[model samples]
Target chain A: MNIDSIQNGVVIDHIKAGKSMEIYNLLQLYNLDCPVALITNAHSGKMGAKDIIKIDSENLDIDLDVIGLIDPNATVNIIRHGQLVEKKALTLPLELRDVLKCKNPRCITSVEQDLSHVFRLTDKQSGTYRCLYCEAKAERRN
Target chain B: MRSLIDILELSTQEIDELIATANDIIEHPEAYREKCRYKKLATLFFEPSTRTRLSFEAAMYELGGQVLGFSEAQSSSAAKGESVADTVRTVSCYADIIAMRHPKEGAPLVASMAASVPVINAGDGGHNHPTQTLTDLLTITREKGRLNNLSVGFCGDLKFGRTVHSLITALSRYEGIKIVLISPDELKLPSYVKKDVLKKKGITYVQTRDLEAVMPELDILYMTRVQKERFFNEEDYLRLKDMYILTPDKLHNAKSDLSIMHPLPRVNEIHTSIDADPRACYFRQALCGKYIRMALILKLLEIE
Candidate 1:
């Protein structure tokens, strides 16, 4: 498959196999006006089959924390002046605000209309995030 | 402003200080009588808890502080669809510090975020009750003379009992503390608590359905009522409920110094026959609640 490379944009590389769509949706790249290329099951030496997303826009601001939580191994390459300006790696964030909703029905955030659903990383090894209020473990959308 | 939302927010040193302060208050009640003469405490009980509410009121009264606010949601602006943040913000203007109890979990947290003054959680659903934990710590300290180097057994409703969870979390901070969990298999301690709190902290603990079997090894016995609502069937509830009742017989092999503690308004889980027992500290625990709360109020108000 042949796809045009972006002149000035971000290339999200080394995503785990079949996870590009979830990342793309969570990142809200689908709503973007600029051209976006999602390449899945691409052969790679490091990852047997990896998914990659190339955003063809320089002005787009991406939330690296979202990417970090989704796939810590993924690398983000910044493009400026049609050249790779910076390659960034992401790690799990200590606290996440409004990213995931607390599924606990008894949680105060569930009733409080204006309250933010906050979660803190409890276990990094298991990728566990628990609700700040009720301590209900966050169920990953995946 | 500082708030008392979770027991973990207070360190072991701070807890020790609070315990010391509570002991001082207990010893010299006259010394703290006029400590908060000009300060006011707002008891925002969105849920009806007459016991905890009166505890706060008595604490404030003993500290020479006036107390205000509603005892139930119907009596407060929360019934008018007022947000916790708004209510707390309004209450902060009328009072020096706020003690809030709401039906929803983390309501006190939201109040803390919004209030200008300190907000203490009286009880927030099945979430946290820091003052209750403080009271328990005070009770245990005064009873056993130390917080560490003892085997503490918790009986009944480990799964949904907020007090048990909070107390476990508080006791986990102490050294040489072993937790023996006693509850029916249906209402056994949650694995997440064991895994997250016990195993993560490297604290020694054991689980069993039989309470009498381990009664001899306990220095302090913390008991919580196992509500029938927790069980799906009447048969399971009937069969398991009586197994945890603390009767004279249950204390047969137990240590004479075992501090039998319970959060009050307890039903048949504790037989009235055992009220005369020297180890029955649940009623005394309620008294300790006021002293510790007075200490907490003084700490929050920065009063002498």
Candidate 2:
């Protein structure tokens, strides 16, 4: 497999192909004016298959928690001076705020428009997060 | 301070304290009107439960508190994929206390762990309804003028009636409290409740399908819906249902002091004619639910 190099940008690697768009939507990258190179069906010696998104001319204000929630395998590599300047692995946040809605119908956040939907990560091992008000489990949808 | 998470979390002394406090509130409502002056109670009902939610709101309002929160999931962020923990943390900031009803077991327990304020479990799945149990306790004490030495007959759907299980469990602690299980063979009380509660407490009891034969012996008749949905065959439901309906004619055999109670929104298990009878305490039971909740709020808030 040939490695593609970007002159100046950040590379999001190891995303399970086609999920890049979901990640894009989650990050709200469609609203950005910066050029985003979304590559799918890329070959990986390690992963057996992968996808890559190379965003040029802009650094992302991405939420690592959201990224970890969407796809835990993703890695972000920042490029400066044609070399990898920084590499960061995503971790789920201790608490999530206004990102995902609780599925529980009776939760206060479901009714109170002004209140932000919040969840506290209880068991990272199981990817279990509970609603702060109703104590409903916020299971990730595959 | 706001939510009644679990009955077990409360010690016997703590329960006694709440009961004593509830009695005080019942005796002197004026003294506690300012207790929760500016406080707000947010009832987040993920399930459809008008009775429990209304009682909770009425409880808070009676204590000079305000009420907010959604009654159904469609109206809330839950439909948008919001999580329970997040809702509780956020709601805690706005409401002084919260009452929650969910379809999942242990949901309120999860809320109680995350919430900064008090969290009450209105009811959860088929697991528990502590407030209902509390209301029953208050009603039994008020009606009988005591908790002990009462023969309480639990009729209709015993297997899935959360109220029956909770009330039986709570009543097991009092001395000389006898329980009579009245249900069809298919709707018998769960063995765990029998073994863990009644047998363990050495409480004497009997189980029978003959409601009329046993009516004269019971001091309290706790009636629950004999749900048609619980029956696999339509024929079986039709056969068993009419056997359970409490009519004014049936009360002729019952004791004059016998108080018939149902955790309401009753289907035809209880006939309308019985509502006019002095022995029908179910409506008053609803009022008791509010007063007990008022006591619960006052005790939980501890305004003294």
Candidate 3:
């Protein structure tokens, strides 16, 4: 299957297999008017099998840090005139506000609907984030 | 300027100073009677509490400060669907300081973030209870005469006991503290607590199923209630509830100087006969709660 490559857009590559849809949802690519392609279980030499999201839009601004939270190993490439202009890597956000929800039922954020869910990165290797309120570990939703 | 959200937030020096202040207050009650005379304390309890609320009220009254606020969420604006932020903001205008207890884990934290005045977390769900930690520290210092180099046996519900968790975290800051976790297999201390607080600090600790086996080596035996509310399985609660009962027979092997402590409202964990024992310091521990809370009130209000 040949998905058309855009002249100017962002190509999110090297996503772990089967995680392209989550990245797409998090990036809210569905809300954008531009064409978006999610290639799942694509053949990759670096990662055994990878997922890729190609957003065909110029001058589109997305939070790379949030993308990092979704899939840190993924690479973001800016394509200008169908040529790679800039390549960026994702890193774990030290603190995330409203991106991750605290799963602890006893947490104040759960009871108080208006409060923003804040999670702070505790373990970098495990990619663990703890709730700012109750200190309960935020479970990554699959 | 920060609020006391957790017992872990207090430094060893601060804890020592608070203990000193509590001792001073206990010795000279008249000296601190009017220290917070004009200051008002708002006890915004969004949950029903008998001991903690009374302790805070008694502490403030003894310090010549006035107390106000509701007993439960039904009486407070919280029942009217008000946010913790808005409630604390409004209470901040009425009172000089706030001592709040909520059913939610971080409700006081939200209040602390919103209130301009100092906010004290009395108790929040199954989360941190810093005042109780203060009370425990004060009782330990007064009973054992030192906070360092002691073997503390925490028995009964270690899993869901917020007091046990907070006290263990606080004790990790002290020197030469060894924790003996005694409980049935079902109510063992949570793994996050073991990893984050104990192992990370390299604090020496041992987990055991037998309380009597470790009784002789303990300088402080802290007992916690196994609450039915904390258990998801009723059968598990019933089976594990009566596992460790500290009676006169159990105390035969215990150290003579061992201070038996408990965060009260206990249920059959300790026999009534054990109350007469000199080792029983749980009552004194409760009284110390008032004095330490008095010290804490003074410290938070910045009153000399």
**What Cα-based lDDT does every candidate model obtain?**
0.89, 0.82, 0.90
Candidate 1 lDDT, B1-304, residue by residue in tens: 5899999999999999999999998899999889999889999998888989999999999999999999999999888999999998898889999999987898998889889999999988888989999999999999989999989999988887889999999999889999999988878888988988999899999999888999999999989987664455789778877677788987889898888999977888889998899999999999999999999999888876
Model 3, C-alpha of B25: deviation from truth (Å): 1.1
Task: By lDDT, rank the candidates, best first.
Answer: 3, 1, 2
**Interface RMSD in angstroms for candidate 1:** 0.9
| Candidate achieving higher DockQ, 2 or 3 | 3
DockQ score of each predicted structure, in the order shown: 0.76, 0.03, 0.88
State candidate 3's DockQ. Answer: 0.88
Q: For every candidate, what is the interface RMSD in angstroms? A: 0.9, 7.0, 0.5
Q: lDDT value for candidate 3?
A: 0.90
lDDT for residue A23 in candidate 2, whole number 0-100: 84
The candidate 3 chain B region of ten consecutive residues with least summed lDDT is: B1-10
Which 10-residue window of candidate 2 chain B scores lowest in summed lDDT? B1-10
The top-ranked prediction according to TM-score is 3
Per-candidate TM-score, chain A: 0.85, 0.85, 0.88
Candidate 3, A98: how far from true, in Å? 1.8
In angstroms, give how far residue B93 of model 1 lies from its true place: 1.2
